[model samples]
Target: MKKYLLQSIRLTAVLLVLLCVVYPLIVAFAGGFSKGNGGGEKITKNGKVVGYALIGQNFSKPEYFWGRPSAVGYNAAGSGGSNKGPSNEEYLAVVSGRIDTLLKYHPYLKKADIPADMVTASGSGLDPNISEQAAIIQIKRVAANRGLTDRAVAELVVKNTEGPLLGMFGPSVINVLKLNLALDELKK
Candidate 1:
């Protein structure tokens, strides 16, 4: 029993160091090798940092493409979803409000044409990407507002659309911030 007790203590100590200490150090080191060198990828424009590539930013103007609805109002520190299920009255009401607001801005969009992501907040409430369909749906309004051709804006959306992981998994997505940045560059 004493030998077993000693073995248990050794195992616990070893695992604690491996998991609690060494693991984090390795992860941090690996992150340093990544794009932002352990920090998030900063998206810069006109020699100024606009936002992070991995986080969402609120863009309400008609000329800018809209991103997913954020439950936390795009507050990164307060990132979270509404936690209400589809059947929840409050959740439905919130979705309804979003739909109404979207319609007000995009009078040409049919209810069915609105992508689900456009009206629903992602789990993180900081999703920087939206479905290609979501981006495409806003092309007309965005083009009209920016005084650009629909074809031009649609081409921009196509240019910014990212394929699924490894070209074979998940639906295509568009980083809304990146797309909007490209749009601004187009005007230049």
Candidate 2:
């Protein structure tokens, strides 16, 4: 019994060090090679910091493409979903409201044509990218609001569209923040 007790203590200590200390150190070291160097990727506008690349932000104005709706109100510190299922009454109402608002801004878009990502908040409520279809659907509203041609905005959307990982993993998506930044540059 005493020998077994000693063995258990030793194993526990080893696991604690490996899981808590060594694992975190390794992850931080690996993150150093990533875009933000262990921090969130910083996006800049007019040479000033605006937001992070991996997080979502609100762009309610008609002149910009909207990102996925965020349940946490785009608050990074409290990122999460609404925890409501598709059939939930409140959830259905929220989706309906989003669809109505979208239609008000873009009366030309058919109800069935609106992509799910446009009206639904992502699971993490922090998805920075939207489906290419969602971005394309909003092009007309943005172009008209910004006094730009539909062709030009569509081209920008095409230019910003990111292909699936390894050419086959996920659906094509466009980073809304990056797309809006490029659109602003085009205006200038």
Candidate 3:
């Protein structure tokens, strides 16, 4: 009985070490060395690191397209949604405020023109992209601010748009940082 107990103890310790330490270390190293988008780092032009495509940024100007509503205000450290149910009064109040703000900036936009993604926070507060339709809705305001033709700005939006993952896994989206940087480049 004593010998059997000792064997069991040794087996438990070895398995724990392998599962908790060795397995995690192997995964970490493998992920670090793996290729494919470098964990979604943003590519920039003109030798400057702009922003990560995976994390959202706040763009309040009329000229730049806005990403989804961020629950934590685009804070990566606090990356989570409000978790409020759709029927919650607090959620309704928050959406109402967002709608008011959007209307103030875009008086020409009908209620239907405001995409659902625009008024609701994503599951993560750090979403870095917006639906392609959302970007299209903001094109007129952006063009007016930069004194460019709406058609010209729309072309830039098309240039920055990214299709669904693997061509079908997700909806078409536009990276906010990339689009804004391209807008700045237009002035150069």
Candidate 4:
């Protein structure tokens, strides 16, 4: 019985180490290879890399289409929502403050023109994409700021907007990094 108990303990330790440490390390290493040497490196133009696609970033300028509100301020390690219920005072305050800020920044727009994504932080808080409607909502502001025609900006937005994955999963979304890069390219 003593020998059997010792064998079981050794087996459990081995399995635990394999599952908790070795497996994850192997998977992470393999995934790193798939992403190339730079891993999370952002693609660039004019020798300037702008941002990563996996992380959300602030775009407060009128010339750029803004991404969703990030609860952790786009910190990938801190990916998570506020987890506040709809009726929570903190959540309501945040939403209200965002709306006010949006209004202040875009005084020319009516209340209805603002997209919900503009005021809401996404679930992961590190979402790099925004809804198509959110991108559309900022078209006029960005176009005017960049001195581009609305049609041109709209076309660019449409081009950057990615469709549902596998043509059936997830919503149509736009990567802010890619879209902003395209916008910068237009100026060059």
Candidate 3 Cα lDDT to native = 0.85
Which ranges of candidate 4 are over 4 A from the true structure?
Answer: 16-29
Candidate 4 C-alpha lDDT tens digits along 1-188: 99999999999999999998999888887777665444775666677765665777777788898888988787777788877888899889989998888777667777787878888888998888888988887888899899999999999999998899899998898999889989988977
Give residue 58's lDDT in candidate 1 (0 to 100).
Answer: 94
Error of 4 at 98 (Å): 1.5
Deviation of model 4 at 124, angstroms: 2.2
Candidate 4 vs. true structure, TM-score: 0.84
Model 1 residue pairs with clashes: none
Worst 10 residues of 1 by lDDT: 77-86
| lDDT digits (tens) for residues 39-145 of candidate 1 | 98999997999999999989988799999988888898889987888789988988999999989988988999988999888899899999988987899999999
Tell me the TM-score of each prediction against the true structure. 0.89, 0.91, 0.84, 0.84
Model 4 lowest lDDT segment of ten: 35-44
What is the Cα root-mean-square deviation between model 1 and the actual structure? 2.0
RMSD of 4: 2.6
The predicted structure with the larger TM-score, 1 or 4, is: 1
Q: After superposition, how far is residue 52 of candidate 1 from its true place, in Å?
A: 1.5
Q: Give the TM-score of candidate 2.
A: 0.91
Clashing pairs in 3: none
- TM-score, cand. 3 vs. native: 0.84
Off by over 4 Å in 2: none
